[model samples]
Target chain A: MARMKFLCDAERCIECNSCVTACKNEHEVPWGVNRRRVVTLNDGVPGEKSISVACMHCTDAPCAAVCPVDCFYTTDDGIVLHDKDLCIGCGYCFYACPFGAPQYPQQSAFGVRGKMDKCTFCAGGPLADNSNKEYEKYGRNRIAEGKLPLCAEMCSTKALLAGDGDMIADIYRQRVLKRGGRPQTWGWESAYGASG
Target chain B: MKTLVSTMAGLTLLFLGGCYESPNVTTYEPGVYKGPKDPLMMGKADQRAETLKKRFELVQMDR
Candidate 1:
C-alpha cells in the first residue's frame, strides 16, 4: 500500500489560495472550520512565500496517539481518519497537532471544545466508503474513487502536489531545480525534528 | 503476594510504553512586530481579506 502525502512547493505557490477554497467547497466545511489554510511567511518581504497548510497525515500521528477515545486511525495509504461517534470532544488532539490542524466547533459555546475536525486527505472519515453520511460529515472520498485531492488538482500553478510520497516529492524537486531555489529544511525539522 | 508484584510490573510497563518524547518544533508565541519596511512590498494589507473573500465565494459555489 502506498503512503499518501501532500507537498506544497512554496517557491511555486502564487498564494492564489485555490487549494484552500477547493478543500472548503469539497467538504462543505463550516464557517469557523478551515480544513486548509495558506500561511504567508516573510510577508511583504523579498522572499515572501505562502504555503498551504493542512493535516500532513504523519507516520506516527500525534493526534492519533493523543486521542483518549482512540477515534483516530491511520489507513494503508497513510491517511489519518477518525470516527465522529467515538470522539469525546476532548481537545488533546488539537494541542498535540503540530500544524494546528484539529478544530473544535463547540469551542464558542460554554467554553467546551467540540469533536475535533481536520483534513481527511480526501479519503473521508471512518464511515463506510462513499456513504452519504461520510460525505456530509467529512467530505468526498476521492481516494476510493481513484482520484486525488481536489485542492491539488484545482491549483492553478500546480504548487500543491498530492499523491504517493515519492511522486509528490519528485514533483517538488523538479520545481525547485527549475526555480533555482534550495529546499528549506524547516518542514521536516518543524514537523518531526532530527530524531524523528 | 506474587500476583500483586506481577500486576505492579505490568502497570509500570504500560505507563512507560505510553510515554512520548516531545519534538523541538517552535510553539506559537505571540509578540509585538517590530520590523523594517520593505520597499518591494507590492500589495495592500487588505489584499488578504479580499483574496479570502473570493476563495470563500468559490467554496460556496462548489457546495
Candidate 2:
C-alpha cells in the first residue's frame, strides 16, 4: 500500500502553471474554485522560487480537526478528503488550514456559503468511486483508477513528485545529495513537521 | 362552464410544472467525458524506473 505524498522541488519549479492547469482540467473544477495553484515567493529578485500549492493532506490535518460537522476523513492511503454532502459550508476549515486549501464556490446574499472544496489527492469523496456525484462534487478519482494525481504526472519538469512517501523521499534525497546542498523542502516542515 | 374550464387549465399547468426536468441531475456512466490521454505520461512503470535510475546514477557519480 503506497502512502501517497507530494513533494515540490522549488529548485526545479519554473513557475509554470501546468500543474495547476492539469488539476483543473482533470477535475473540470468550477470557474471560481482552484483545486491547485502555484505560489511564487520574491518577485524580480535573484533566485526566486515557486511551488504548486493545494491541500498538503497533512498527517494531522487541521481542516479535519476544525470541521464542526465532522465532514472530513482521511483515506487508507493518507489522502485527506471531506464529504461535501455532510459539509455545512462552515469556513472553520479554511481558517484552520495553514495552506489555505479549503475554498467555497458560492457566497450568496445573507451569509450563505456553499460546500467547501479542497484538493482530494485524486482519491475523491465518500460518493461511489468514479461516480457522477463524486466527479461533480469532488473531482477525478485517479487514485482509485491506479493512477497518481494528474498535477504531478503532468508536471513538465518533474519538479513535483507524487507517489509512495518513501519512494519519492529517496528520489528527492538523492537529488539533493547530488547537488551537494541542504534539502530545502519549503512546506515539508510546516505540513508534515520538521522531524517527519 | 367557465369555472369547469378554468379548473381544468389550472390542473394542466400543475402537471406540466411537475414534469419539468432539472439540468443539474447528471450521471457519470453516460455523461462522464474524458479528454485525450497524456502523451507525455511515460506511464507508471517508466516513471518509477526513471526516478530510480536517476537516483542510482547520482550515487555512481558520487562514488
Candidate 3:
C-alpha cells in the first residue's frame, strides 16, 4: 500500500470551514487547538483562493528531526504522530514544521506548557487501535476503522481528498483533465516533497 | 552581626551557584523514529489497503 496523503483542490474549495469543523468535532479537540483550518490567500478580494490546511505529514518531517525528546514517528502509511508523554512542550516542532501544524493548548507564564498537538491523519497514536486512551490523546482511529480522515470525507465541495497518495493523485489529475486546465493542488509538493 | 551577615552572603552565593542553566544542545540522529510503534502497522497491510480502497470507491470516488 502506498503512503496515505491529503490533497486540497483549490479550484473547488469554497472556504466553508466545514472540514475544520468536522475535524474538531470528530477529535473533540481542545479549545485553541485546531487540527484543520481553511486558509484564504486573499480575503474578500477578487479571484481569491482558499484551501484547507493541516499537518501534511511530510516525507522527511522536520518536526521529528527537531524534537528534543525524540517523540515524533511516522507510520507505515506515512502518517506522522508523536508521543504526548514524551513531548516537552518546548515548541521546537512548531518552528520546524513548515505547515505550522504543531499547536499548544495554553499560553501561560508559569512554565506550564501543554503537550504539543497536531493532526494525526485520523490514525490516532501508538496506543491500541480505537482504544479510549488513544482517542483521548490523539483522536479517533478512523484509519484502523477502514475509513479516511473526516476532514476530506466531509468536505462539502469534495475539494479535500485523502487516502492513498497515488489514488488521490489520479483523482486530482482526472479533475484537472476534465476541467481542461491544470488547477493547482495546494501544498502537494511542500508536504510530500517534489516527487509526488 | 558579622557572623549573621556572612551566613546570609554564603546562602545567597549557594543559591546563585545552583542557578546555572543547563545547555540545551541535542545531538539529533537523522531518520531515527524514537516513539512507540503504531498498532496499525501490526495488522495485515494488504487487508487494510483493500478495505480503504473499497471505502474510497464507496464514498470518495469522483464525487
True contacts kept of each: 0.00, 0.00, 0.69
Q: Residues A1-196, candidate 3, lDDT per residue (tens digit)?
A: 5788988988989999999999999999999898888899878998888988999999888998888788988877788889898888999999998888899988587756699999999999989999999999999999999999999988878999998899999998898889997654446774587787
Candidate 3 wrong stretches, greater than 4 Å: A107-112, A184-196, B1-31
For model 1, how does the per-residue alpha-carbon lDDT over A1-196 read when each residue is reduced to its tens digit? 4567888878678888889899998888878889899999878998788899999999988887777666776665567777777787888888899999998785576778777789988877766667898788788877655566789777877778776676566666666777686766367754697688
Q: Which candidate should be chosen as best, given TM-score against the real structure?
A: 3
RMSD of candidate 2 to the true fold? 11.5
* Model 2 lDDT, residue B1, Cα: 100
lDDT for model 2: 0.75
Return the lDDT, model 3, position A136: 95
Q: Write the per-residue lDDT of candidate 2 for residues A1-81, one digit (tens) a residue.
A: 446678888888899899888998999988888888899877568878898889988888888776776777665556777
lDDT of each: 0.72, 0.75, 0.88
Worst 10 residues of 2 chain A by lDDT: A182-191
User: What is the DockQ ranking, best to worst?
Assistant: 3, 2, 1
lDDT of 1 at A153: 70
The TM-scores of all predictions, comma-separated, are: 0.69, 0.71, 0.82
Cα deviation of A179 in candidate 3 (Å)?
Answer: 1.6
Off by over 4 Å in 2: A183-196, B1-63
For the candidates in turn, chain A alone yields TM-scores of 0.89, 0.91, 0.90
